[model samples]
Target chain A: MKLFKDAGHLFRLAGVFLLGTLSFLAIRAFVVPHSFGQYGHYRGAAIAEIAAHPVHFAGHQTCETCHSDIAQTKSAGKHAQVNCEACHGPLAKHADDPSIDPGKPDVAVLCVRCHSASAARPKDFPQVDADQHSGGIPCTTCHQPHNPVIAAGGAK
Target chain B: MPGVEGFMYPNEISLYWSVLIVLYPFITGLVAGAFILASLERVFRVEAVRPTYRLALLTALAFLLVAPLPLQLHLGHPERSLEMYMTPHRTSAMAMFGFVYLWYLMAVLTVEIWLDYRADIVALSNSTTGWRRWLYRILTLGSQNVSERALHIDERVGWLITLIGIPSAFLLHGYVGFIFGSIKANPWWSSPLMPVVFIFSAMVSGIAAVMLLYMVLMRLRRQPIDMSCVDTIAQYLLYIFIIDFSLEMLDLIHRIYEADESFRSLDFMVHTRLWLSQVVLQICIGTLTPILLLFLVQVTKLSVPVRKRIYVVSGSLALIGIFAMRWNVVIGGQLFSKSFLGYTTYKMALATREGLLVSIALTILPLVILWVLVKLLPPWPEKRHAPLPAALAAD
Candidate 1:
């Protein structure tokens, strides 16, 4: 007691810190999510929550049912590996309602996104200068929509 | 989409870290640097630099308080930052910063200040009147003992805290460097010497800042500027700056020597995208100009007025240079694509949450806080009236 005789200030400061730390721990316990750090350092429920969300994008199988002729043309062409909805936006809503018209994608803009001339893409990936090649004409005017290699009259 | 050049990845088009991220390291660097300057007088017993000792500590606290605001504003969900303290990711450098900040703020800086000022608080509580009396009374923490033994204990404990603080200051900014340095994925930020360079730069900026503040504050109060103190501080600033510049050059030379796959892309970025900020402003105006000015004063037998002007110009340039360094590190690192194929641009939005206006406001907020703190607890050595507000000064 003699050592701490005039240390009432230090005692008071310690008391303040003790109360503060305890209060902080209590508040932290209250706020921290129960599911947090369950699997790792994140809320475990997030993975399942994201998974439970409804799936979009009707498969190429779904598109084949409605337009078998286009599917057959796409299968034989240079775009054999590509999917029906790859160029088109998500068609889950249109797939649900058959009457819902998924409007045609604008080939002037759409075709260039992948086919734009760039050093990044592989050498033989069939890229083009959309500005000089088409010159404002829609891509469908020069080539078939499904089989782009075969020209509009079915000649290569 | 508009700012894209070369071959940026689809996801790398829009930058995640903005100008706010630039301020985060810059502000924290000031805190680290200021604390180191204060610790020099306390821990090292550098008698000549005694004038700015308390001012440097107060400056550290003022800037340390504002340091987290930039990070919070940058976060998408600002509220979730607290969760870092609750369950910190053991490996995450950013997450661990919360604990480092809390330790430096609450455990180190605040405790050291209270202990250092306990005697003054108790004495002022008795002498002062009204809310000021109550304010000092609360600061005294119930015990009014300014006894010799009590004061001795405060000094001894404060010394110990300052000893702890020297390394803690290093950890504070060095860890900030580690935050960028440890990002092994980005070649620009992945240097092993980032922490050392950051520490030295922090010291340079922090020293320059206090030197400027001391000169300006003295002029405002119509007091004679302490020439010897400024001279000593300027000497240290110059030396530390040399080390910092050398370390940075070393990193650059090493990068050039070992030209990795990403070097060509980074080289192009430095030439084109980063030329203005990195090459012109940061290098020429910010770093070298100030170094040359300080060097002139150091070597030459200049008049007091001339030396003071040189100090002001050099200090201002040092701060600008450090800020530009932080800008280049945060914004520049993100400008180039990770694939070594492309580059993008950071278009600073106007009048938004993370914008130039908010950043300017955030930069000024610490100075406003320093003003209030100076009024509350006078850091000056001489027995003069505190710079109270007009209404309070009348009392």
Candidate 2:
């Protein structure tokens, strides 16, 4: 009590600080999402909200359903493991309605997304200098999108 | 893939932390540095530096006010930043920023500055009229008593705050360093020396900034520049710069000797992409040249005019060096792919949100704030008691 009397102004300052801090903490407690940090660092409900979003990219199995011939050709090629939608944009809408063909891809752009020469890429991967190799021609002009081996002058 | 030079991870294609992130540390560094310079006079009893004591505090307050702006601007949901305080992740280093920033702002800087200016504020409140009087009155926080005993208490409390402020300043900037250093993914940023380098560099930049401001302000006000004060500050700047340079060199040497898996990739980057910014500008033009110029001043008996020129040149260069250091740490850390396979480029947009224009604006914002703070507080002692009240005039 004597300490407070001697330094009442300091106490007032401290009191102001405490009041501000408590107010901040109270407001924080009120506004923070209830389900946050339930499992990890973020709101758990966010995961559910994200999952609830409509699927955009229809999977390879769905692509295989309608275009079985292309799927068989792709299966026999070097890009057998590559998914159909990896080169083509999300096709869930096109998959549901066959009347709307997803249309031909920008073959040069799609090919170089993976094949662009980079030291970081795996050595055995089919890399290319798009400008030098193709000379302004589309990738689909020579190499078939589904069967790359046959069009690259390899065994069919 | 278009802007990318080499193989980058799919996610690394777009840089998450932009130029605004670089400004965050640079601004915070200035705040921490200015406060530490203020502490030299208050706590360390450096009488020669008394001229800069109040100005340093106000400069710190101005920059500190703007310190979090860049971070806020950089956030995807700037409004949601309040969640940091509300539901802070206990395990994350970034989460501690809110508490640290708050404590420094409220408990340390604001309180210390208020106590230091309480008597002046009370006097101003009584002397001024209309809005000015009310402004000072509100500023006094209803504690109008400026008795000798009250002032003595204020002095003691202010001294204690300055003592605490030194370490808090260290924590404020060192924590910024740790945010980058603790990221185990990037070898460029993940070094133990990062925090130490940051603290020393903050000291260098802050001292240099205050020194330059003091000279420029004195020239503007038509007051004679204090050579002793500038000399003392330059001495401190040189010493801290030496330590900062040494620590950075140590980090470099360790990396070179170890030649870790990330070494080849980083080495390539330093040789190619970072050659201009890191090597020529930061090291040669900014760091070494300033250190040499300041060193010459220390050894020689040059005229005041020559010494002043040296101080200005060196101070400007030190600031540029430290800014470059922040640039290297923040931007350079992101330039290289985590896979160590390729590198990417940062094409700073002109007028966009995190563009060069916004960065320039943010950089100048603190100076404008300091101008306002200096106008309101009038940090110079000669200007402090211009309108003293009669009752307090006797003391």
Model 1 CAPRI rating: acceptable
Candidate 1: clashing pairs of residues: none
Top candidate (TM-score): 1
> Clashes in model 2: which pairs?
none
Q: Tens digits of per-residue lDDT for model 1 on B1-395?
A: 48888788877888899999999999999999999899888888887888898889899999999999998888868788887888878787788989999999988999888887787788789899999999999988878877766766677778899999999999999999998999999999998899998999999999999999999999999999999999999999999998999899899999999999989999999999999999998889989999899899888999999999999999999999999999999999999988888889999997899999999999999999999988888888774222322432343
Q: What is the Å distance of residue A34 in model 1 from its true position? A: 1.6
Error of 1 at B7 (Å): 5.2
lDDT of each: 0.88, 0.87
- Once superposed on the true structure, which residue ranges of model 2 sit more than 4 Å away at CA? A1-6, A44-156, B1-16, B337-343, B385-395
Candidate 2 global CA lDDT score: 0.87
Scored by DockQ, the top model is 1
- Candidate 1 chain B weakest lDDT stretch, 10 residues: B384-393
**Predictions' DockQ, in order:** 0.48, 0.29
TM-score against native, each model: 0.85, 0.83
The sequence of per-residue lDDT tens digits that candidate 2 reaches over residues B294-366 is 9998999999999999999999999999999899888899889888988888888889889999999999999
